[model samples]
Target: MDLTGKVAIVTGSGRGLGLAYARELAAAGAKVVVNDVDAATAEAAAKEITDAGGTAVAEVAAVGRTEAAEALVARAVDEFGRLDVLVTNAGVLRDKVLWKMSDDDFDTVIDVHLRGTFTCARAAVRRMREQGEGGRLILIGSPAGQRGNFGQTNYSAAKAGIVGFARTWAMELERANITVNAVIPVAATAMTETIPALKPYVDALRAGEPMPPFARTALAFGTPEDAAGLVAFLASDAASGVTGQAIGIGGDRLSLWSHPQQVVAAYADGGWRPGAIAEAWPTTVGAQLQTVGENLPEPPAA
Candidate 1:
């Protein structure tokens, strides 16, 4: 996983999983561009890496907009001479059910997670193509996006769109030798604190308690650093042939998620009428109805 002499960018790297990723990449010998919406935190993050004998610089940008995305790529070029990896980790969450989700809530999440990914990848790919060197575009995805989650309509859509980007770009950039993959990370960050089931575990960790094995193994929840390892591995040459995958990682678990595929299919001889379809539904597709949401195991008795 030696990234020596490579230049990389990690957006929203002021803290949380993004911070862990930037630090790991820098530690692996990559010159990192740490980007965040908060100027103070961004500078602080960059300094922390530099003070640790790693090369890093801060770039403050909101992400999502073409101008901000382009500026991040430009910063890497200006400071490190070339861009080798881009981790689109910047995002916001707006949780609400369909009935109660306002337009603003929907738009905010979409702008940050979905559109932000598109713009940043566009800018990064262009630069990577110009350099004519193979590169890595690691996009962050969520379990909420993989399987529908309650009260997260906006967030789910945006994250799903991110994975969609990875699949599409993998095909589009194959000739360019640029690999695209979506990382589905589970960690105890401020983001996960919002999930009711994970809150107690998150709070316990904040109070200096060890994370329970059940949460680590069963829920696949752990520290941000637990998930950071996967991001660094995907960025390295070791994963050069791995592309268009939605890989999950956390505490004690690593998984490969399959793209949408039909488990079973039924056909009608002459395009059956509505009455015939209604009669056959229960015995056909309805009988194999797929489950939604994460299939979590029952926790050990307290």
Candidate 2:
């Protein structure tokens, strides 16, 4: 997983899982460009890496816009002289139940998560193509995207879209040798601490307490650092042939997620009527109906 000369840009990386990914990539020897909307945190993240003896620089910009994406890629090339990886980890949560959600709420989440991933990948891929070396595009996804979650319509859509981008880009960029993949990660960070099921563990982590095996193994929930190694591995040369996959990592768990594919189908010889489909449903496709939503067992007793 040596990345001695590879240069990377990780957006929304001032804190949380993004920071962990940036630090791990730097530890793997990649010169990192840490981008965040907040100027202070961006600089601080870069400083922290530098203090730890890793090469890094800070770039402050909101990641949704194409201009910001272009600037980020430009800064990476100008600073480190080449761009080899782009981790689109920046996101926001404007969640509400579908009926209660406003347009701005939906738009804000989409602009940051979906549009940000799109524009950044576009800019980075162009540069990688010009450089003529294979590159990695690590798009961040969530379990909500894999299985819908209540009050997270916007977030789930955007994350699901990110994984879609990975699959499509993997095909389009294959000849260019740019491998694209989506990471479905679950970790306790600012983004997840407010989740009711995770708050206790988040609190415990802050108090420097150890996480229970149940939290780490069953819930796949742990500190942000737990998920960082996956990002580092995917960003390195070792994951060169691994593309077009939705890989999950968190806590003590590492998993491979299956894409949404039909498990069963029913066909009519001459396009059956609705009545005929209804009659067949009980014994056919409906019998294998899939489940939805993230369902976690209660955290082990306090």
What's model 2's overall lDDT? 0.94
Note the Cα lDDT for every prediction shown: 0.94, 0.94
lDDT of 1 by residue, 166-280 (tens): 9999999999999999999999999999988899999999999999999999999999999988988999999999999999999999999999999877789988899988999
Q: What's the TM-score of each model vs. the native?
A: 0.98, 0.98
Clashing pairs in 1: none
Local accuracy of candidate 2 as per-residue lDDT tens digits, 174-230: 999999999999998887886888888889999999998999999999888899999
Clashes of 2: 0
TM-score for candidate 2, please give it: 0.98
Off by over 4 Å in 2: 300-302
Stretches of candidate 1 off by over 4 Å are none
Q: lDDT of candidate 1 vs native?
A: 0.94
